[model samples]
Target: MELPLDSPADQLLLAGDQVLLVGSSYGGRPLAASRGTAPGGDAVGRIAPGPEVPKLVLRTVDISDPAAPHITATLEVEGAAVDTRVVGGIARVVVRSQPASLDFVYPSGPSSEQRAAEINRQIVEDSTIDHWLPSYALEAGGQQSAGRTVACDQVHRPASFSGFSLLSVLTVDLAAGLSAGAGAGVLADGQRVYASPENLYVALDRYEDVPVPETAAPETIPATTVPTPTAAPPASTAIHKFSITGAEPAAYLASGTVDGLLLNDFSMSEHEGVLRVATTVGAGRWGNAVADDGAPVSESFVTTFAQDGEQLAQLGQVGGLGLGEQIFGVRFLGAVGYVVTFRQTDPLYTIDLADPANPAVRGELEILGYSAYLHPLGDGRLLGVGQDATAEGVRTGAQVSLFDVADPADPQRLSQLTLPDGWTSAEHDRHAFLWWAAAGLAVLPVEGATVSADGSAVAPFSGVVGIGVEGDQLAERGRFGHPAQDPTCPPGPEPRLVPSDDGGPEAAAVPAPPATALPTTVAPSPALGGDEAGAGTSSVGGGSSSGVAPAVVDSPWCQPFEPPISRSLVIGEVLYTLSDAGLQANDLQSLATLGWAPFA
Candidate 1:
């Protein structure tokens, strides 16, 4: 099934008769009338099209008629939809945003800093809790909702100040629709999300503000040097857990704090009523902490948590797993766990999680490259998909390795395949990788762009690559991609979408070319922690903020991805590949093309 989604989707969910699409950040006029709290604490009766005000779009399409799928409902919310999970008959979406409608004076340098700061503080103090919660408008069937604000009673706040970003987890009943759902807020910022059938977890890094002495003038403060207490602060992660076991609204169960930051949702798992977490500490978010001699000093650890009333308390922790290295992958399988850390060589450590109170490393395997994502391949084998690097840590391309983990004490790489210059969407999104155990097939979206020695031209290709999971090896069976657009243009930088004159969205720019893409031999992956972009001035009146931007910045990949395949699925004997460009179906056995449907 295929339907046009103006904005890029961060994730997709398939329900019985509907396909749900959600984009973290969108910049267009509301697809339908919007009634929500505007970014600046004002009531937005109807939101207009503009890039200035960030928006999250959630559209549900009725796919009952495969040949002509259409959007039946849309909820345009004032915030970024971080991630979502569907349980039984309800979908819970986590959105991170803040009230930006308040107009505070922008400081005129150090002289006006204190005054602006004070003005912002007053505005925040005077504002109600509704100003900090996400607002939304729902349009379904021919009915519209005048949504209510997230009640103060439903929101959870941290003991210390945790920035201005408010995280809201909204629930929508799949069968009952959005009218019967509600949302709750957590007074903290979050990015990575992990969910099981029973619970969902959101993990985000906490920033420490260096306080200036009340006696010191703004101009007298040192710009680069720390005043005092400059010991390297341990990077911390705040996790919020919610129960999704019932069809009722998602209930905020507990919240906890860890001493490190997570790589992604994979860094968290729930088993036997306990939550296991993995993170990298002693680094500044991105694991770039360095010693006086310019060596990496970051370390990783695994922690366990159990519910204690309304709080999640730490139970046990195993640290020093990868000294001077950061975590690349994590997966907790039942009573066992796997952690991958990489610097020059990849160290795969298997942990014993049977005893939640005493987790320990049982065995380790060192390999040349690292796996950013891992999947269990039946019985006792693990499949890894990530960049293949040389002994010097220079990444060559994407590699797929099968490991024998049946023997936890002695893990070994059974077979491997490396594509010299390839990149896959699966490295960052596990949803993009499909494991069909019944057919012994593993499918993923992969691309490789080969530039001429002079770098003037390139051959760029992207498609669904099917790898046969034979007895002990992984070999490529076949690959296929969508038909190229007429008179193809070379790929360069991915075009960013901006608000159009009519309130619709359009690409800011497109790569001009002689029909070739410009992707580099090595794919770019922002390890663990990410860069926080500085916010430029907003419309004059908006008050002061810390380090948060209106929306999160994109990754560091420079080359433009012209509709890279993002997901693949198997239905009986047909394999379906999906991307922004369209959806394609091929024979599950012979890689023969069956059909292609472009989104309208």
Candidate 2:
């Protein structure tokens, strides 16, 4: 039964007989607020459901053997429940109600469906949820780094249509510092629409507001008169993307295997004239061949790809022969035009494309069990991640590793330091392990990582880590689920791998160990910053521009890793996910998609 609330309830908790709560399964948590309409006026409220059962259908199971088998009560509810269905294991709860006095806001009492529809509409219309232009810099020669400056008339409008989010993208081609022209189109569900070459730039949000030609009442806005586009301040432009994964394939033996989107996920980024992609590939049904196979005994390789909206190239791979997957984590190390891949276990690889047509593995380094993320130091080194393990089977813990790849082929593992751990709030542990078997590893670089007050420090690019890597070595760095943070870590006296779905008898419970987070501050050193070299040309969006000084673009942030439903391929800047569902191109940067083209 649907519980009456401000709108559609994201989660429902029914107590007394059998308690159950439903919510978002991502990060094992629910959204902050799920708006809905009660039988009254308009309203907004935080998502919360108290221990009150509106309705319950009970069922009984007849059985014997008190310890092994027994009869238990069960209740089933109707309608759409929270995506999450966890019993007594609930962690935190939050609830909010719309002020009664605010009822005036809605003259027409919206139905529950209407409220849900409106809420969805608002989500889709929010084009600037967090949009911004990155900072850029100028350089000699008409040629410049793709991220050097923002297009004078470039505009990005992320809107929602249907259940999908659509980005009405427009960019202006600038010759020197002036507009060459404008092009525009919609980017929705793997599709891209753009303007012609002569009309290099297409104004976004602006085009959305253009009044439609008169025809009594226009159903949609016209293709003109959109508000003049505004530039996204540097500070407002923060980087967010995946850089690593957990559970190394190398750690697994012939019979060992792991299935996790935690590390080695695929991602993409754009360079001066090419687009790049990076991803992981471990054991699936035929992931890697056994040692004695007569054939090539093909090994699974995690690779990244790059292209120019058409042709593609494989730029990097990791864990080629080892049990772990390769290219688990990938990042576009600015300036050198290299894509860095964090290994599932040790020795990270950097694919340098100084020669775009013939991109080669330029750097390598030996470190810990796996790399959660990697940030370019800009000069020539990288800020890498070393993860700790968690009780839930996830290798947790965070570490900062510096690598000197002045010579990409001979990258050196410089220093590794485990960061001090702690939860963001008093209510949280030193480090919040939200997912089962999920060891969090997202690095937030401070200082030297440049950006204007607006947050757009677009430049030669440096200082940032994404997520994912291996599990074999994570144990050495730190234990997962230290009892200090979670008493449940150690189960009674012994430890055993618990089935991710259910805790069975064969599974021995082990004692929990102590876990911690890394320090946010660190001393600035040559290893932290790449070798002192020319900053190189940088652009805010893409292509050439003037009036900007060369700077380093910080790495993007690590958002939650949402495993796609198919096999994915990353080569250079191009990403291809081969799923029964089809193939598409993914943006490596903000992860905001550009478009997708189908193939046979």
Candidate 3:
């Protein structure tokens, strides 16, 4: 699954307090076409994967001992890990695959477009069901399976047409030591997934009145096969609901349509017997022809639906919020909803959903910066994570805001902590954020570096930033760095938290280590970005030139091979983070590095 802007995460599932599953899951742009062998070659005439493409690698870990967690099993599946969900102790992994006919040299290229289309159709019709579905290999109990396929029934064509791509939902029982559980398949494409305790929803963008170019969409709907929307203006989205209630495979329950496209999992929420989704309507697909007056064309909306017979019928909707901007953050908490949109500034709008059929915008508050993620802090308060921008809307760096929504119609900004010139994955990836209520700490993966005017990094650092929240105030509890991937290129400097020039409160630094101090990391290295101030530095691909650089680079920044910590968990008094390098545990309260272990 390939997508831009949004990076689908490799999920880490923590089962109770003993285990964690980390790898591909959630949001993708279907499958991409890769080059194969020559005509009538291995892949051209058969169902073979691209030579350069590898199957999704999943690791099942035992975290019972946080300080020394170990991998219990590894499963490799042939496809992109689309998503995963755990309920009633069983985990469901969704994967999408498109066995391509790469390197299909049609005897010095096909004669014409029609001829190329004909050849492709033949390849599809001749392929069997197993070839289109996901196949997996599991290694556990000191044994490895040669391979296994996601079993399902005959591939039936959808009446509306959804191409011949394969998407599978595989069940896995972690307690059973990484066994590939009962699996099922559907011939559809959707990047977003929303799940309730009893239901799983897949939302596919719909191109109703939009005119898609012939090259972007399939030449024809296909007599019975072809892909869905490849590139088109989505006027709405079709929701396909599947039941994950019992032992049987995820059974399709119903279907419905909602105006505009969904933002993320937060875009849809299932309450009582209704489903509410927030989206940006009128997403311009007609490239040049936007609003005639050069105004913001797309608008934000909250629409509600309820299952009536076999369809999710639309009931009510509220629109006209954030005239021209898209949603930055969306959170539906029971009968209330919060949507954040940004352009020149941030507008945090509150929605009243007490009456599902009459959802309306209750109140709104405008601020200088916008929040990308929102977390409930109990007692009518919300924690927002995003960038602190200038009055002109230029993002300075990372910003943390505590909002008092006690009065929904009149929300207030309780406190603000703005960091000038650093970046954090937690801004876009929710999986990278952890809120431990018991300890009153919010931790997210952050990377800070002193970038010179010429664009070279002075001392780049990466790790987690702990934010202490109580009532309406926010404090920087501590900043921790990761073990260097290369001793030669050490994480530039340990980052220290500082206050902004705007007279904001200074961060209470992590106390100096005493003789009794738990094993910890290096000292603080200030993250300096021009005149703005930020907290700690971080890395997706630890210290890589690009946050998640795909290759090696000989630069000023640390080119450490160690992958930076990306996901975290709070077990008892210890905070554990995971990365390709290994696992590290920290003393929860003081953010003292307690222990670090390398993987096998």
Give the top-scoring candidate (lDDT): 1
- What is the C-alpha lDDT profile of model 2 across 253-315, one tens digit per residue? 000011111122223344563434332332222333223433332233333334322223445
Best by TM-score: 1
Question: Which is superior by TM-score, 1 or 2?
Answer: 1
Decoy 1 TM-score against native: 0.75
lDDT for predicted candidate 1 compared with the true structure:
0.71
Please write out the lDDT profile of model 1 over residues 1-600, one tens digit for every residue.
446567777666777877777875555433444443323232324322344567778788777888999888888788887878777767888888766554444442334455556666787688875666667788889988855436567787765555577788888766554453667777878888888889988888875644556566545555565655333455788888888778767777778888878888889999999999998886664346457676657888999999998688999999878777788988889989999998878999999989999999999999998998999977999999998889988998888899999989999999997666788878897888999988999988768734221233334545666788899977777655654432233354555566666776554554332334332322121211222111111111112111112222233333343456788888888787777766766667876556555565
TM match of model 2 to true structure: 0.29
Counted clashes in each candidate structure: 13, 115, 24
List the lowest-lDDT window of 10 residues for candidate 1: 537-546
lDDT tens digits, residue span 207-298, model 3: 66433245532333343553343333557776766777764566556667777777788899988868999988755344221265657767
In model 3, which regions exceed 4 Å deviation? 1-49, 52-78, 99-159, 177-181, 205-235, 283-293, 449-462, 483-565, 576-586, 592-600
For model 3, the run of ten residues with the poorest summed lDDT? 527-536
lDDT of each: 0.71, 0.29, 0.66
TM-score computed on alpha carbons, candidate 3: 0.69
**Candidate 3 residue-wise lDDT at 98:** 63
